[model samples]
Target: MQRYFVAPEQFRGVIITITGEDAHHAARVMRMKPDDQIIVCDGVSRSVRAVVLEASPQEIRAEAEEELLQDSEPAWSITIAQGLPKADKMELVIQKGTEIGASSFVPFESERVIVQYDGKKEAKRIERWSKIAKEAAEQAHRHRIPSIQPVQSWRQMLTLIGEFDLALFCYEREGAAAHGKGIANAVRQWKLEREKSSDEVVQNPRIVLLVGPEGGFSEREAVEAEAAGAILVGLGKRILRTETAGLVGLTCLLYESGAMEGA
Candidate 1:
């Protein structure tokens, strides 16, 4: 069945009014007609199975049939703090990261970052990235769309480190060796500790995974990250590219956290 996200206000009572691009996609592109079964999410956790009541150029209305649970979301709210890479690599990151279950993305300027985003270009870049995230979420059948934060400086990224329960600094060279703890081990420890807590406690823990740019983080930045309480860890033996590290690490993190096994 086809799925699209709509605003909570649109889902008034038993009716779901899909407007804007989604409506256009259904009515014009897909050529959906009345009685066509589809799913609509409220951009939150709530989703309902609905049958199309009307399809037009302006809007598509559907009659709600049943409320369904959003079972695809991971237990851990994973956020990727990606270093600004060159070209269209960031788009690939946002697209695959959304599919891999990242809740949000934060693109920051790193010490080794060569690309710069400023003025109107920055705004347009973020807007494009946001759209990619939304499309990826919809294609993946995600209940909630992942957010793309505006680009920030390296120091600015540090200030947000304390917001997460765990902040993984993706350093392939010296991080794991210096910390003496691999990514898998850290995840294992987190899980074991969480299991010891009460059921109602620590319901949804937040995690931040930070990956550097093409040139990667400098030694000074690595030291600063360590001081900021960011856990330094390596993905594996072979070094992964900036674009690949976040997704690979996220996959391992989700699998280890029991998210890939399903709730």
Candidate 2:
């Protein structure tokens, strides 16, 4: 069945009214008609299996048959703070990151970043990224779409680091153990500690993964990041590309947190 995300207002007492882009896709693109079955999600944690009652260019209304059980969302709300890379690399990251179970994304500027922020194009850029996230979520059968935050400056991004339960700063260079450890080992230890501290699962725990641009973070930036309560970490033996490192780290984080396996 085709899946569409609806607003809280769109679904009322088992009536799911999909409007705007979803309606256009259902009506014109998919050629959906009355009696067609579909699944509608509220983009948080709730989803309903419904049968289409009416389809038009502006609206497609459906009647809920039963509430669908959804647990696809991860226990941790992971956000990827990517240092703005060149070209469409950020698009690839956001699309794949959403599929990999990221809760949101933050594109920020770093000392080594090449792409300068375009204030005039920022709105359109973010709009495009948001669309990518939504389409990816639907294709991935995700209950919620990942949020794309406004691009932040280096200092501004640093100020937001302490907000997360754990922040892993991705550094390509292999440094002393004091600097960092293998991502798998680090995240596993963190998870173990969390479980030991509280027997109950900590759902919705906030985690932020930071990956620098082409040349990676400078020594000064590294020291500042650690000072801001972020753990400097390496992906593995080989140095991954700017866009790939964060995805790999995110997968490691989610898997270690028991999200990849199941609820």
Best by lDDT: 2
Clashes of 1: 0
lDDT of predicted model 1: 0.88
Task: List the candidate 1 regions with Cα displacement exceeding 4 Å.
Answer: 175-180, 193-201
User: What TM-score would every model get versus the actual structure?
Assistant: 0.94, 0.93
Worst 10 residues of 2 by lDDT: 171-180
Clashing pairs in 1: none
TM-score of 1: 0.94
Per-residue accuracy of model 2 over 1-263 as CA lDDT, tens digit each: 89898778887898889989889999999999999999899997689889999999899989999888888888789999999999999999999999999999999998999987798999999999999999999999999999999999999999999999889888766433445587777677777888888567666789999999988899899999989998888887677889998899899888887887833
lDDT of each: 0.88, 0.89
Clashes of each: 0, 0
